[model samples]
Every structure is written in structure tokens, then in C-alpha cells.
Target: MEVVRSSIVLSRGRSRLTVTGVLTGLLLTLSVPAALPESGAVTPERGSAYMGMGVLAHDGIARGATADSLPDSRTGQTEGVDVSSYQRDVAWSTLYGSGVRWAYTKATEGTSYKNAYFTQQYTGSYDVGIVRGAYHFATPDSTGGAAQADYFVNHGGGWSADGKTLPGVLDIEWNPYGGDCYGKSKSQMVTWIRDFLNRYKARTGRAAVIYTATNWWTQCTGNYSGFGATNPLWIARYASTPGTLPAGWAYYTMWQYTSTGKTVGDHDRFNGGTTQLKTFASG
Candidate 1:
């Protein structure tokens, strides 16, 4: 839920090409837009940004719980973390030694911006024997979801059957822009998400992991429950426990418990032990 100032232009056609400004030193050119369905007929009042950039920008705010509070290996859970370019030059060895069993690196944002540090972070974590995955920060308002999915898959977000890599993730959280729900109604948001997931699945032969917060999902999507059965849920909550999950998902696969962790970036946990974690990554 970071705010990036992007400049976008829309053209009338089956496909749209966009050139986005450099963000955190990453420049991107996007060319993928299928016929975008109009936003839902009803324009609901905008909701508050769930994980607003302003909140994440201030690290001084008490992060409630730390990685130390998590259940130990005896509890059958595995430790992990997620990073973006904001965590520059990560010490992969240090993280691995610190018991980080896996990692998910931000690869692309919107249709246009690609993370400059994705390659190093992804491969470095893998070389250190950490299960790794790549995620795309979604901007459903910019264009059609199918187009964005195509763009993401073409980039580092593509999935492989290699047992060390987890399937790609879709990070659809609070919008940093003025509108909380990105101006899309409940039904429209669902449609956009479905489009993205369908295309991503078709390309990778696996469902993408969804990274979202409970508040945002409920407010923006009207608590839609369709994706739970197929896509794995990666819930972000800053407390010791995962609290209440969004509708549809009976359980969470991964929980991002804190943004300011003792070891580098956001601390996460796999719902199960090392063996189950490997099985999850193998898909």
C-alpha cells in the first residue's frame, strides 16, 4: 500500500499502451489492454484506504507485534518475509541465517512499473535456499485486468514448476490515490479481479496467491467470496494473530504479521511447517 505518482493515458481500442514515470528508479512501458468493461453501474461512496501509504511511511508508529511473538517451529509454522525495492540491497545470507524460510519479492506494480531490485532479491533468496515467489501490485483502475495479467506474466511474475519457487502473487490492497476503492463499485472490483486471476491462471497453469487486508477486501469488494476456493490468501494484519479474514476464505495460507520486522523487511509466516511449505511452493 505504497503511494506512487503515476502518469497514465488511455486510448480507445482493444489494446492500450501506457508509459509510466520512473518510480523508485524503475521505469516501465506497458502495452496490454483488452476491451475494458466499464466500471459497475453503481458508484458507491468511496471507502477509507485500508493500508494507506501514509501509515506505512511512518515506521515509528508502534507495529503492535514483532517476529519474536510468532509461534516457534514446535508449533508447526515457518518464518518468511516479503520485500520491495524500498528494502534495497537485502542481506540474503543474514535473512536465511536468521531463520527466514521463504520470501516474496515485489516484481511489478500496475501495468507499467517493474521493481528494479526484483532480480537480485528473488535470486539471492533462492540461492540462500529460501522458497521464493514474485508478486505484482495491482492497479485495476488503470486498465483491464487481462491486460495487466499479460504484462505481469511477461515480466518476472511468471511461475515455474521448479519446487523452489511459489506461484505468483497478486497484491491488491489499498489504493494510494485519493479514492479509497479506486472508484470501482463492488461488482466492478470483482469483475476486474476475476479477469486478472483468470488470465494469470491460464498463463501459469496455477492460481495466483492473493495479498489483501480484511478491511480493504470487505469495503472494496463487498466481501466477495468467489476466489477463496482457488486462490490462496495472503492476509496482512499487524497484530499477533491474523484477526478476521475476508469472506470466502475459510483460512489464510500466509500471514504477513508485520512490516517493520527485526530481520530486514515485512515478516510473514506460512500456515504450516517446512514440508507443507515446500509442497505449497512446488505448485
Candidate 2:
């Protein structure tokens, strides 16, 4: 989620370096491959982390979800959170004591970046009896979906048959980059998404959860209706109600209600009870 940047400077005979020298130095510095973060180091970007207030404002909701209560009216809703390296040193036991029953941590982004804290966060959550899941932030414009899926699975996005582990989630929401659709046409976007879902299902033997906002889905993929029957929808809507879902999904499996929740990370709720959540994870 973070982008690493490097800077270089040069000097000549007690004077500042010339433009040519500076440019040469810049080129040389850029040529050296940027080192990825060391284990437990923070990545440069935490996607959607800082956008919580804006999203909630767009929905006309002044207050974000609190740990004191569920975000929705649904009975038996299970509380959860999704975390990345931005959330440092989480108290998993405290979260569990506060009724957080599950967690999904960022495992990989695009095809190259892996969350440095994935191991600790995932294990810590599971150790405290929280159903744990891994998620990948999609960058369809960067590479083919199948390739990214391979990268995700090979890194840490794969699922096991453990009843306490949920299926991997694919975060295909608004591009933090300038282009909302990553410059891909709607059809191309849908094709890339389908490719990712198909490859992930083939590899893990379970459908991946799709995380997206209603407006982003409509704008980027023309509100594609194909994946709902196969993939569980993890809709992101920061409102009192979940509002309307994307096409083809009658109900959302998970609703991410707020990023600035009382929990240490983004707060979410499962649409069903403990048994249904366990069943979903068992897949």
C-alpha cells in the first residue's frame, strides 16, 4: 500500500551540482531498484485509510461506527475489522473482548507489494479466537488478474479448510490514483475481475470475497452483475444503512461501515450470525 521514494544530491568543487550532474545522479538513483520494506515495516500507502471521513460525508453520515454497537439493524450481526500496516501493534485480545469476532488483514497489493505485518496480525487475530482472513488490493491496470491472483496466493492470500479462516477478499474499489477506473474501459475492467476470481477459485477451491463501493463499482465496471452469484460481496458503504448494493447481489456478505471506528482498524459487520460466519469460513 506504500510507495517508496528516493532522492539524490551531487556537488562539484564547493559549488552546487549542475543541472546535468543532478539529472545524472537522479537517473542513477532511480536505476537502482527500490528495496521493499523489511518484515514488520510499514508500507508507504494505506489504501482507503485516510478517505474514511470523505466517504462517510458523501453518505451524509456524520458519525462513524462505534465499538459499543453494531452498525446495522440486522440481528446476530458479527463484528469484525480489516487492518493493514497502518494499524500498528494491535491488541487482538482486547478486540476480541470487545466483541470483534473476525478480522481480515491486508496480505498483498497489486502483484508485488506484501503487507509486512501480515504474519503477526493474522496470527495474533487468530490466536485470540478471531476468524482471520487475508485480502488483496487489486490493481487491475498494473497486471492481468490471473497473474495478480497467482502472486496473491503465492504470497499469503490462499485459504485453508480451517473453520476459523475466511476466504480471501479481493478489494476492487475506487482507485486512489487519479483515474477512477484505472483508465480501463468497463468491459476490460469486468474481464480483468472475472479473470482474477476464476483463477483464485481454481487455486483455492473457494470463491473470493469482492470488496467494492456502489459508486466505484458503477463507474468503473458499469455495475457488473456477473460475480455476485459466485463471489460474496463485501460492500463498502459508510452509512447507517448499507444503502443499495451493486448489481446482482441481493445482500452483502460483509458491510464495511466505517474506517474511523472505535476499533484499531476499519470496522465491519457480517450479515449473519456466528454459525453462518463459521460456515463461510469453512469453505
Candidate 3:
């Protein structure tokens, strides 16, 4: 359907706007916040960014794990899911009924954006018996690791020994806005991540979980294995198995198996059972 455009265009050094266009623009301006940046330099609506949004956006959805890569068994693994502002007001009760015992909610990004739905997604899951925690989408190009870590914890990523609250996660992956690794060389990238992890540990007394894909960790950090000793790994792979984890760990704590989950959000599997999961959370 073609839009009908029949209006006199105002001519001046200022610009050109049809009489009808003026009314529409006025209404839009009045309703929209002037604070929102009109360019790509700023983060989008609060909570809109989710884990793997960049993975599926910049890297094709088909890039990761394949069906043949699945493990022979997933027996006794705890069901889990991850959510962000992208899935506003998730069906926590529904997910709980479906056996999703754990969840991670996007809490902050860089030093700026914070998930607007942190409360609903974070606390709601807890209320429904889901052990829950928050995550920070790292943007090394935008701020120092310590700053971003501070912002994340201050906003929603803080951890406690409570059995219901899992440690925060550091979502470091392909840069959705630009080059992979946020344009940092392997050494610099590793340094930034160290800053974040150190600050996070100082603040919360728990090493935040490191969430990344094998390819990303290899590419961005040059296959650095230093972090595996301290931080638990939450491996992301759209494939069957978490697929050859980044250089460090012998095992993965949680595996985000698919971005398109069976139920509400991205599906994951805890590598352990109830007691193990609680122990991991408490520590």
C-alpha cells in the first residue's frame, strides 16, 4: 500500500515539513522523551538487551552448536532459563511449573543501561521458587571494567550467600555494536575482564560467573585460561552440547543450550543437581 502524500512543504533555510507532518511530529515529540539518543551510540530501551542478542544479531543464528553435537545424556541436570528486558514480565510461574529451577536476568550494561524489568524478572522468579541472579552485558569500549562492574552491582547484580540468590554473571561476548571483543586486543580484553572480576569479588565476596561462547573466548581473549580457576562458567551455545568450552574449565556450571527455548526464555541446564546448585549459589 502506497502512502498518500499531499501537503504543501514549508520552504526555508531551516528545513522542509508538510503541514500534516508538523502535527504528527509535534505529537511524537511531546510523547517521546528528549533524553533518548537518536543515534546508535547509545544503548536502546532499558532491559531491551538480552544475553545472546548480539550473538544471534551479529553472528548468524545458525553459527553455533548443532544437533549432532549434543551430549549422550542430560540426566539429573537441573532445568534453567535466562531472561532480559527483551522478554518483559516473563511467565515465572509458568516456567516454574515447567521445571525451570534457575534463572539469570539482565541487570546492567556498560556503565549506563540497567534493565528496567530487573525487579519483575529477578524477584518474580525467586517468588516462584526459582533460584535467580542478575547479569551484566560488558561493553569494554564504553567504560573500564571496574566502572561497569560497579554499575552492575549497584543496579542489580549484587550477590549474597542466600540459597535463592546466585552470583552475578559477566556477559562478555561478541560486540553487538562493532568489532568483536569490543576492539580490545587479547591482552587488553583480559585485563578489562580481570578488573571487573576483581572488583566484583571485592564487593560481593563471590566470583561472578563468566558467560561466553567458545569461539568468542578464543577469539577475544586468545584462548586465555586464567579465569577458569576462580569463576564458574556459564557456557552459551545454540548447539546440542555446550561445545568445547573456552580454554579454562574442565566442566561447565550452566549451559545455555538454545536462544529459542521451549517455553518463555532461553533455555539452560545446570550441570549439577539441587544440592550442587545450592552449594554453588551459597559460595
Q: Against the correct fold, how does model 2 do in TM-score? A: 0.77
In candidate 2, list every pair of residues with a backbone clash. Answer: 1-45, 2-44, 2-45
Mark the 10 consecutive residues where model 3 has the least summed lDDT: 24-33
Segments of candidate 3 deviating more than 4 angstroms? 1-47, 57-74, 261-263
State the lDDT of candidate 1 residue by residue for 1-283, as single tens digits.
2222233332221122333432112232223322223353222112211121322322112244433453334377788888877666789888787778899888876777777777899999999999999888777778888998888898898888888999988888766443657789999999999999999999999999998888789888999999999999998775567788989899999987655422266667899999999899888
lDDT of 2 by residue, 118-183 (tens): 888899999999999999888787899999999999988999999999998888865544356778
Tens digits of lDDT, candidate 3, 129-164:
899999999989999999999999999899988898
Off by over 4 Å in 1: 1-74, 261-263
Clashes of 3: 2
lDDT (CA) per prediction: 0.70, 0.71, 0.74
Candidate with the greatest lDDT versus the true structure: 3
RMSD of each: 11.5, 13.1, 11.5
Better of 2 and 3 by lDDT: 3
lDDT of 3 at 194: 99
